[model samples]
Target: MLKVHEIFSSIQGESSHAGWPCSFLRLSGCNLACSWCDTLHAGDSFAGMSVADAAAALAALGLPLVEITGGEPLLAPETPHLVTTLADAGCTVLVETNGSLDISRLDPRAVAVMDVKCPGSGMEGRNDYANLDRLRPRDEVKFVLVDRADYDFAREIAARVWTRQMVHFSPVPGRLDAAELAAWMVADRVRARLSLQLHKYIWSPDARGV
Candidate 1:
């Protein structure tokens, strides 16, 4: 069984798949506590459901795009199974992971959008660098920045990976100005795409179920 936080249809808010109509299955719990975490409430509550049931419900959403996200979905033992099940059902599955866990075990049909936490998150040490080798051509790397220090850190990583796959640099809205980050990227010619949380702009940042 999996402890699921919510399953709802919403526009893909981040990553290369942003703006697509997608269904989200947010699992509960996380191993890392990033300082700027927006979904702390996910760990505070959850409802247990079997993997089959979870996949079934998501398929019923009828959206071709489905994402298995979380308070860190990779933390759940059932996540890989849930992802594979959905992929088998012909859904273009995207798994959003926090870069602390092993991602190679997931089904090849599913794409992974792995977040390489920046120093501002205070969880950089939790990163498993080995996961970098596991990223597929279709996979994506994400860095959520809050300060210049975070931006510098992400810049180094993006230089190495951006040429091989998709890399996104997103600023923590209140802490770092997007325009400022954009200017820095322009000056440095950073090899990454500036990602804004599109859902936050479409609705309240705190709103759930999109």
Candidate 2:
């Protein structure tokens, strides 16, 4: 069994799959605390359930996609097994993780939306640089910008380290404005696609389980 916060259905709010209807299996616990973390409660264990139970909950939703997010999903030792179980249930799994963890052990079939923390996050030094080498073209890398400095930092990183096809640049909700980030991306000619937390805008900003 895995520590779990909640399981619900919602639209993909970040990464390349944004706007797609998906079943969310939010696992509990994280190794880092970013300043802009919206799901602080997710890291605090509210319940526990097995992978099969999680898959069954998602199957009941009848969604084609299942997003396993956190408080860093990698904190769960059984994450890879959960991904396989979800896939076997015919759900396209997407794992959203902080880049600090080693995703090398995860199933390559799952779409990884790894978050690369910026200076504003205070945990930027914790980013696992080696994860970049494990990325496939189908996978995505996300950088959350809290200010212009974060944007510049992300741009530099993208130019030097990341050359993935599906790179995403997202402004920290309520910190940096999306329009400003989009303008910066255009002016700098950055290669990453701009990502907006669409669900936040669609629903209450404080809403849980999407």
| Alpha-carbon TM-score of each model against the true structure | 0.98, 0.96
Predicted model with the maximum lDDT: 1
User: Against the unseen true structure, what C-alpha lDDT does each candidate score?
Assistant: 0.92, 0.86
User: Model 2 over residues 129-205: C-alpha lDDT tens digits?
Assistant: 89888886677888988999999888887775455448889898778999999998898788889988899899999
Runs off by more than 4 Å, candidate 2:
none
RMSD (Cα, Å) of candidate 1? 0.7
Q: How close is candidate 2 to the true structure, as a TM-score?
A: 0.96
Worst 10 residues of 2 by lDDT: 156-165
lDDT of 1 at 158: 79
